[model samples]
Target: MPPRSGSRAKSTGTDFRAVEPAPLILLKGSEDYVATRALDRVKAELKSRHPELEYTRLDVSAATPGELSTLASPSLFGEPRLILAEDLAQMNDTFLGEALQFLEEPADADVTLIFRHSGGNRGKKLLDALGAKAVVVDCAPVKSDNDKLDFLRQEFRAAARTIHPDAARALVAAAGSTLSDLGSAAQQLMRDITGDITAEEVDKYFGGRVEASAFKVADAAFEGRTEAATRLYRHAVATGVSPVAITAALARKGRQIAALVDHRGPQNQLASALGLPPWQLRQAAETARRWSPRAAADAVEAVAQADAEVKGLSRAPEYAVEKAIGRVSASING
Candidate 1:
């Protein structure tokens, strides 16, 4: 994946604004947020160039080659056209031949072709062919903790403001690692606070919900930190995170730990099996060591009971979750 653009504008405050439009643009890889942002940039630039530009969007995965060829062909009105071919990986062999043949000759000067492909080898032949003629921009996922931390810092910095490291960490912990979610959280935090931000300010803005996030609460509970887990649970509930989401997180974490026990593979393979990032796998492995296989199974059963109780069986959902947290904590200790 290509490195994200470095320059920032005062108004847009993003690298996308600096990108010039390309004839055959390939947004490669699986980072949805990044790819979407890049796509927006291209559209914005094109709109700026020709206010009345005609845009023809086609999902190549579904559209026939004849349809795509006609759309990409020169328009009768001579108006500039912006052609978007989404899901390039699903482009059939027939369309691939037509597209490659079209690229062989010079295209209409007024036309721009943007191909969006989520990562995979499904259409490697097409991707390689386009590489010779396309301006490829990588949109790979952010995998490491440090990279995510950098993203948080850059987001704040782009706004001509700064966030304290502890505050940033707390925000990431609560918001989860996905870029779209984190971006939304950052916007909320900025809207709710002014001047330099601190951990206390973050906690206050989120109404003490940072520690109460499902992942944090479950992490504490799974390691037998009953006091911390209970406190977080109360705060999370008070802040309006649904009880269902809370219990669901608990059940998922418990299941991950239980599954880790039965797996006998390298950490990377184990992480892949569990659909977790490497760092998260390490955390789950550490937590798994605190429990016997029987205890882990018991915790999973407790979580299932909590899930049911919170939904309907119990009148007091809060107390049911609290009791489940205690049960799981004891299991970890055992």
Candidate 2:
């Protein structure tokens, strides 16, 4: 799957299969196995329900716009199939315009067509048009520690293994959040350990402790710890974090801080306003303690400037990002 572009952009994962008796579904998110795993489980259930199902995978990346029109055709063999178009985002405008027309009246056959577009502006219009008829979901990057842990549990289940709770936490923190990496780490752990893997076994093979700690970048910046934040920002950037990505992180944090001090009503209401779960209120409260209205206001301005810089309005994305970090850190600390 491709990566999501811009805020609010949804990611597409694997194809979706129907329940015993239901319409086709869509699970949108990152290249994470969660969505892919959902597809797998759906297929598993579909098999027992309807054994005659057929599956088709198509890579639509290099195909010309005219070629895309061919996807609407029925399968050569008369069988139920799940068709996945892997690179729908790369499809040309001509293809997208044509797609908009077909989405309105899709073929109601035994086949289900799933278009997996990681995401971007390339086919925004067509995708949005299919929103009501088709499921248009955003597969943003994972942020919650719990979500990552749940992903780890799913991994263990796939291996026909069970891990201790503490061990799962260790794997999440030690392995980082990417699905492919987590799966590899889980397999190695399962293979290396003869029996059910315990938390103790995790410490021996995993090695991402320091890397995941880079999340400290946001913690320090929001708390106004300029020194720690600056050092961590440099380290994260040196580790290959893009200037644009770093700036986006700041933008996300800034929005979070702004939501905290939204004094329009009881602070509890702020969670929904921020699109964060209720548990985030604890962290928001703590982070808000260090933030003044003036500081949050300034941080917002800084992110706006950085966005322009990284987006090509300015020649120096790195310098612009550094400036935003400094401004936010100082404001939070001051």
Candidate 3:
């Protein structure tokens, strides 16, 4: 029989990191890495409790009519079951009808249904139903540096290890913007290091990678260090970082500084308004201090030209990027 209305199986909008095993779990967001991790946790927890758990995977996009019911039905031996239904965002009409029907009278407590919807309006009806009844785990994209730092901290905290905030920032800068890459780097550090992780340790392991990144060049350029920016750009390009990547970094930096040039509101308010972390806003504010409105405009123009040049407008993309770096540095210095 279906569980009572107020059963413990329902969660009140749980985060991906805090997901618990439930009869109906919905990983609803666009971030596959976080969703996969949450699903793995649920699977592990279920396995620990039911050693002989019958695991099944269903592609809801290709599901046939009544497939979900067939899978959720009791087996002869009555072993617990875990049904991981993926691609809900691309579910067909047949699956959608069955899913809605299944929701009206869900399977027994021994059956667990996990739905992975990677964002869309394709299955809004089913999503609405799951949102009200299932343990909804948000698997939203972690795009900002602040969110990435939180993820890194959680990784260490999960293992009962302490990661210095500076170390976490360093890892984020070194690891690029990919969550999976950052997670793997954190896991490797936790496995290899003995004590609390430090910035020094992070640098020792990833300093070269950081040096080769376009961010280093962009940072130096925005700081008005012309020589350092030029040197870093050359080194980054030599290390296989493309001219396009360098121009992209410069464009991003310019946008950040330009956004804060004339802002007079409270720092936190501005950060929230701009959808940027406080630390990032603080850094941009520091750079903006040296930049007048005209200078910021000039930097933007310079970055735009470089972006065009790198994207096939000019043959000497390397020289174009170097020229853009020099112009940005000069504008900041002025």
Q: Ten consecutive residues with minimal summed lDDT in candidate 3?
A: 3-12
For candidate 2, give the lDDT: 0.62
lDDT of 2 by residue, 28-127 (tens): 5455454565556656776676688866666555556655446545657766666665666677656666566556554546656565666566677766
Strongest candidate by TM-score: 3
- Candidate number with the higher TM-score (1 or 2): 1
lDDT top scorer = 3
Off by over 4 Å in 1: 1-18, 191-194, 207-211, 214-334
TM-score of each: 0.57, 0.46, 0.65
Cα RMSDs, all models: 16.0, 14.8, 11.6
lDDT of each: 0.72, 0.62, 0.81
C-alpha-based local distance difference test score of model 3:
0.81
TM-score of candidate 2 on Cα atoms, chains taken together: 0.46
Which order, best to worst by TM-score? 3, 1, 2
How well does candidate 1 score on lDDT at residue 73? 74
lDDT by residue (153-238, candidate 1, tens digit) is: 87788788788765665565556447787777788888877767654455455524444576678888898999999888888878
